[model samples]
Structure formats: structure tokens, C-alpha cells
Target: MGVYNVHERLLVARSGEVGALLDTLSSGGDGDALWPHRSWPPMRLDRPLAPGAAGGHGPVRYTVTTYVPSAWVRFAFSGPRGFHGFHEYVVLPVDEERTVLRHTLAMNTGGPARLTWPLVWRPLHDALLEDSLDRAERACTGAVAHPARRGAYTRLLRRLLRRPPGVTGKP
Candidate 1:
């Protein structure tokens, strides 16, 4: 792998219970509620996802976008500029009820995207990965008790869930 390769893997949910969660992860996230009074705008979808892209390939593709609000958020990058990267997740069936999600994130620095991370983003990469995945777990947990979606929160969640990602819904 190239130095550009940075990864984070977490077993938050069982192999079987992660399908919907995987869908939500690859799709995007809603920050309005989480941020509440913060000025951070809603999470946007540069791309919407479809289901079935479970293996090396899926029946469809999904993609989502997010940005760090404060420069001090501490993550893949915690410097003057924030870190922005797109994540792809693949949801696979481990057993009847177990599904394995493999997540992969790609970020570019210095060379392009008008983006750059601190010189040692690798050290902090794992922490950021864990944080993002933990948040995803929270969303998935709510989906279980919550109705499919009844209000504005559900509306945004739906938007995120719809983007199944062309790649595995792992991340």
C-alpha cells in the first residue's frame, strides 16, 4: 500500500446487525441535531447510494460527505485546515444475522484537492476513524427503536441511508 493508505476498523455492531447501519454510514450523517446550537450546516450528499454493492462490488453505489466544523476538532488533520475525505463501506453477510462492514477512507494532502493534513496525520488517523464509527453506531442504535423516520431528523437520516455507496459500506 502507498503511504496515502490510511485505515480504521472497528467491531461496533454484530456481523448480522450492521446492514442498515452500514447503509447509514456510507450515505452520510446529520450534524444539525448532534451539533444542536452550532452553526454547522446540515451534512450534504455529494452522492447518493444504493444497496447490493456488498462484495468486491455491490448491486449499487453510495457516497456521502462531511466536514470538520472547528479547526480544533482534532482528527485526520488538526492543523489550521480541516480534514476532508470520502469514505466507502461494503456490507457483507457474515451469518444469518451477522454482517461484516469493511470501511475504507481516502484523503489527499499537499498534492491536490486544495487540501492538506498535518505532516503526521497517520498517528491521529485511527482516533478519527474510531470517533466517526462510534457516532455511526449511535445512529444505528437509534434506528432500531425509532420509527423508519417520522420528523426532520428522520428526513436527514433517510438522505444519509439512501446513499449505499458504490463500494463496500464498511467505513
Candidate 2:
């Protein structure tokens, strides 16, 4: 099953500023000042963000398939068991004082992902992207005008992950 996911945020900075910050983050910089409040495994690339570069943590992995400085970037999945496709980030200038930062994921899930995606991955994915956008906004404007909030499902999942295995209260 193919999944197309998109998340965007309007920043007070121009495309160049926001794009530069994103580039820094993607390059594994020490700029925790603009850190995204991520609930999922953080992305770590083996090299700077560029074509053919590869990275990802946890159940996700991909290779940089396309890159355009200060504008856009694309990554093609190479792992995570059943993810086949790409994701990208684009910085669009709304005007000199505004920019739109968009992140898009287009991929087909197979094997267990078909089930895990809908039942588990989707919520986490959405939350992650929203947080990413929030971080981008903070990076540009020095504040998160509207921080991303996790839905009930995401909160519940977090609780479950913290539980001890085989400790189910019900028989």
C-alpha cells in the first residue's frame, strides 16, 4: 500500500533561512537549539544531505535520491522492511518575509508494514512530522506559535511501550 503524507508550516523567515536550518539538522549538526520534539527514532545520516547519501534509524532507512540546495531534497527508502519509495522536503518562498516548509513522504508498504503502518506507524508518523514542522517554525521565528500535541492514541502508545513485557493485567 502506498502512503502519501505531507506536513507543512509557515515560518517568519525566508526560504533561505529555513532551508539552511533544515540542511544543518539533516547534516547531523549540533544545533539542538532547533531540535524537533521527536517521539520516533531520530534520523542520522552517514554524510551530509545530498544525492546518494544514505541514512535513517530504527525501522526506516533511505538513500538521498535528489537534492537542491536551499530548495528541496528527496530520499528513497532502502530498509525498514517493506518500505519502498521516497520522501522529500521542500522550502517554498511565500514572500520575502514568509516561507512554507513542507515535508512529504510517498511510499508503498508491504509485508508486516501493511498492518503495522495503519495500526501503529501512521499516528507516530503524523506526530513526528508535526513536531518537525513545529521545530522548523521555532528555528525561524524563535517560538513555536502552535506546538504539536500528541493525540490520545499516540499518548497511549507511548504508555504501552513503557510497560513491562508479559505484564498484561488481563489473562
Candidate 3:
């Protein structure tokens, strides 16, 4: 199965201001303002944001294959057995005081992922990206006009998939 997913938000901020968020992915600690670490697993890279840096949140794993500071970054999947392709975040300038922050996940699933992608991964991935965009909006404008809320099934899935305290795994 081939899966193509995208999530984006338009923020009333300069492109430079919104673009800087791209440089902060997986910085760890409290430095990453674009990922919603408070509600989801934090994205962690093996090294700083750059080509070849590896790591991912939860059970998914990928490696940074391309990066343009303050503009864009792409991560190619390397694990979970069946995911093949990349996910990327890009900043698009709409005007002097408007910017569109977009994330795209394009991949092909085989093996078990053929089932898991639609049943489990897709819901979680959608919610996570929405939360991520909420973070971006909040960081840029100090508020979110309309926050994304997880559905009942997604909440249940998260509860069921959450790792125990001190155990390293999906949220």
C-alpha cells in the first residue's frame, strides 16, 4: 500500500520566524518548539539536524537524508520492516507576514505494515501531525485559533500503545 499524508498550517508570521522552526527538530530537551512533545513522543536524532543523522520517535525510525537550514528537512524511513520512503517538513512563504508550514509523509507499506498502516499507524500519525501544527501555530502566534482534538478511538489507541513508565517506546 502506498500512503501519502500531509498536514499544514498558515501562520501570521514572517517566513523567517516560521522557517526557523524547521531547524529545531529533534534538538532534544526543551529546544524543539515545533514538535508536540508534551502529548506525544519526542523526535530524537542521533546527532544534530543534518544529512545522515538518525533516530525517530517511538517505534518508527528514520534517517535525515536532506536538510536546508531554516527551510526544509526530509527523513527517509529505515525501520518497522515495511515503510519505504520519506517524510518532510517545509516552510513556504506566502507573503511578508504569512507563512505556510507543511509536513508531508509519502511511503509505501508492505508486509505487516499493509495492515498496520491503515488500522493503527494512520490514525496516530494524523493526530500527531495535527498536534505538531498546533505547536507551530502556538509558537508563532501564541495561540491556536482551532486546536486539533483526538477522537475517541485515537485516544484509546494511544492509551493502549503507551509504554510504561521508564520504558522507552511509543507514547
Candidate 4:
């Protein structure tokens, strides 16, 4: 299966201001203003934010393949068994005080991922990206006009996934 997902937000800030957020990924600790790490798994890189740096969140693993300072960064997936492709975050300048922060995930899934991608990963991925966008907007504008909320199914999945294998409910 081929999956292409995109999430974006338009911030009322300069491109330079918005783009600088790219540099803070995995480096800003708990105060990372762009990645929504408080709610989801934090992104971690073995080295600084540069090409060849490797790391990912949770089960998804990737290596930084391209980076253009505060403008763009791309990661090529290297694990989770069947995902092949790249995901990237790009900053586009719309005008003097408007910028678009976009994230794109394009990949092909084979083997078990063909099933897991749709039933398991997609929902979580969607929620995570929206939250990321909300963080970006809030960091740049002081607030989020509309915050992303996880659906009931997503909440249930998160709860179930958090439990240890062979452990069921309240023992």
C-alpha cells in the first residue's frame, strides 16, 4: 500500500521566525515549541540536527537525509520493517508576515505494514501531525484558535497500546 499524508498550518509570522522552529527539533528538551512532545512521543536524534543524524519517535525510525538550516528537513525511514520513503517538513513564505509550515509523509508499505499502516498507524499519525501544527500555530501566535482533539477510537487505541502484553485490565 502507498500512503501519502500531509499536514500544514499558516502562521501569522515571518518565514524566518517560523522556520527557526525546524532547528529546535530534538534539541529543545521539554520546551520544544514545535513538536508537541508533551502529548506524543518525543523525537530523538543521536547527533545534532543535521544530515546523517538518526532517530525517530516510538517505533518509527528514520535518518535525517536532508536539511537546509531553518528552512527544510527530510527524514528517510529505515525501520518498522516495511515502510519505505521519506517525510519532510518545509517552510514556505507566503508574504512578509505569513508563512506556511507543512509536513509531508510519503511511503509505500509492504508485508505486515500493509495492514498496520491503515488500521493502526494512520489514525495516530493524523492526530500527531495535527497536534504538531497546533503547537506551531500556538507558539507563533500565542494561542491556538482550534485545538486538535483525539477521537474516541484514537483514545482507546492509545490506552490499549499503553498496557503491557499479557496484562489485561485491573488485575
Candidate 5:
């Protein structure tokens, strides 16, 4: 529960859309990234009903947990060998357009690693969080350069069926 390298900043020239971007990333995490996550359905995360589902960018109360890739989960599980839970927090400006994003990776411990958190964990966490923020910024700015865009399931099925012989096992 103690502080672990907390940071807060304003993105200046960008705030509203930026805030929207943060909300999208924080709330749109479904176990499967391929699905149409930006919606309110069984597949999509249900925002936490604790605070209330009214957000400046949109309506949402809470999400069960932000979706990190299996790889991230694996790293969190293996790299730190004690305790088990690290949740993220996406804080938006209460009044301004800027968003205050916090990815607090926490755990319960008093082991050797805990002793070295200042020296080791801080640096590791810093780098990881930096990458996360950078990506979030890209999504905010509509400049996510290149990562294959999502398409409908039926479209993919059709494409697979229409593939040339060389593209598939058909002869």
C-alpha cells in the first residue's frame, strides 16, 4: 500500500482526445484482443460500478482488470517470484483535458527482491511504463503507425476460404 515511484503529468496541447485514448486502452481490454472490444457486451469488460459509470469521455464505472498480453502476465509472474497481483490505474484530469495515467505494479513482499526494488524494480518499471505511455500517446494522436488493423470474423473466414492453393493446403 506504500508509494512505489508514483508519477503524474499533464500532456499540455492534448487532453480531451488524449483522455479518450486512455479510457479506450484502460477499459477496452478483453481476454482476446481480436474481438470488437470497444463495446458493452459479455465479451467486453464491464466497467466497475463502484464509482459510477459516468466518465467525461464516456460512460463507464470500472473494468475487472486491464488486459495485458499473455507475455506481460508471464513476465510479471516469473520475473517477480513472490505474491500475485498487479493492477493498473488510469486517472484522468478531474477538470482539464489531460489524463494522469498510472500503471501501478504492486505486490506483497519483504523478500530479497523487495530490498532491491529501489535499485532494480524502479528502473525496470520505469522503462516498461514509458513504453506503455508512448503507445498510449500514439493511440491518442491517431498515429499508431502500423499494427495490423482489426477486421470482422466473417471477413477473415471468407479470406481464408478464398485463398489461393499455395496460400492454403489445398491442391
Candidate 6:
């Protein structure tokens, strides 16, 4: 069981604006310009973002466990085995012109996660979150000093995963 948290502060946007940005991502993904940098898989909920709503992307399935409008939302994983916990987004206001956005993943990895987490999941997660925050910053400030770039490791992992399993690693 491990509790992992990641966050970003929007120094140039208001709480409502940041909330709306997050809502846009939650509802329809970040589109082409920002898709690759999302912290979470492109979510596609069957219903609206609210408590008890069910949805997932890729290999993950979850049910919304909590929702507090533009402030917070949590989803509890229901599949992929050994993953028992929830991931959530929280929005906190720093001032009338600034906001803090956070994402938290708290779970107990039982089966493969214990191993996969350290070797693969953690690295990918960190990269993705930082990239997502970079996009957020760009959205708020109209520019970012340094943009996120997928490195060799991330690219290799993506390529490997895209290959059909047990294919002798030839692609």
C-alpha cells in the first residue's frame, strides 16, 4: 500500500479558471496539443463527472466515489487486480488570482503492482504528471519556459507496450 501525491500551482490563473481547465480535461481530454502530457489516461466517462459515475480508459476501470463540483473528485479503481484505492483531484485557492491543483493516488498494490510500480509505473507517472502541470502552466500563463518532452525511456516503454506481447521484442 502506497500513497502517492502530485500537484501543480497555477500562479497566473484564478481558481474558477483552473477548475474549468481541469473539468475540460476530465470531460473531454486535453486534445491533440496536450494529449501526450496528461497525468492520467484520457478519461471518457459514460455519464457526467459525479459521484457513482463509472468509466475508464485503456486498462483501468473505476467508479466515482466522491465529487465536490469544481473543487474535488475521487474515483475508486475496480479492476486490474491488486489495486485497491482511489485517485482524486483537489483544487485549492491561493488567492483571488492564483490556484493550486493536485492529484493524489492512494492505493495498496497487492499482485504485480508491487513490482511494476517501482520499475515502470512510478517513472511513467512522474513524467506524465509533470508534463500535465507544464500544460496547465502554459494554459494559464500563455507560455512555458521549458516544455515537457518525452525522453528515450518513456518512448521506449511506449513502443514496447505497443508491440504485441511475446513477440520476441522485435518491432
Clashes of 3: 0
C-alpha root-mean-square deviation, candidate 3: 1.3
Model 4 score (lDDT): 0.89
Worst 10 residues of 5 by lDDT: 69-78
Clashing pairs in 3: none
Ranked by lDDT from best down, the candidates are 3, 4, 2, 6, 5, 1
- Give the winner by TM-score: 3
Question: Candidate 4: lDDT of 93?
Answer: 96
Q: What is the C-alpha lDDT of each candidate?
A: 0.36, 0.77, 0.92, 0.89, 0.39, 0.70
For lDDT, the strongest prediction is 3
Q: Write the per-residue lDDT of candidate 2 for residues 1-171, one digit (tens) a residue.
A: 989988888888988898786676454435532335245555777887778788774557888898887788888998778888888888899999999999898989999889988888788778878877887887688788888899999988767755367664311
TM-scores of the models, in the order given? 0.37, 0.85, 0.96, 0.93, 0.40, 0.80
Q: In model 3, which range of ten residues has the least summed lDDT?
A: 162-171
State the number of backbone clashes in model 1: 24
Model 1 — which ten-residue stretch has the worst lDDT? 69-78
Candidate 6 Cα deviation (angstroms), residue 147: 2.6
lDDT of 5: 0.39
| lDDT by residue for model 6 (14-100), tens | 888767666654466444232243444566677877877887655667899888876878889985676788877777899988888
Q: Which stretches of candidate 6 lie over 4 Å from their true place?
A: 29-41, 163-171
Lowest summed-lDDT stretch of 10 residues in model 6?
A: 30-39
Model 1 lDDT per residue over 1-171, tens place = 123443323334564455444433323335222211122122233333332222111121223223222101111322223334434445545556444444565544334324323333343334334444444455545532212213454345435535556854423
Query: How many clashing pairs does model 5 include?
Result: 4
The sequence of per-residue lDDT tens digits that candidate 5 reaches over residues 15-38 is 445444444432445532211333
What tens-digit string does per-residue lDDT give for candidate 3 at 4-45? Answer: 999999999998998788788999858998988888888999
State residue 131's C-alpha deviation in candidate 5, in Å: 2.1
Clashes of each: 24, 0, 0, 0, 4, 0
Model 2 weakest 10-residue run by lDDT: 28-37
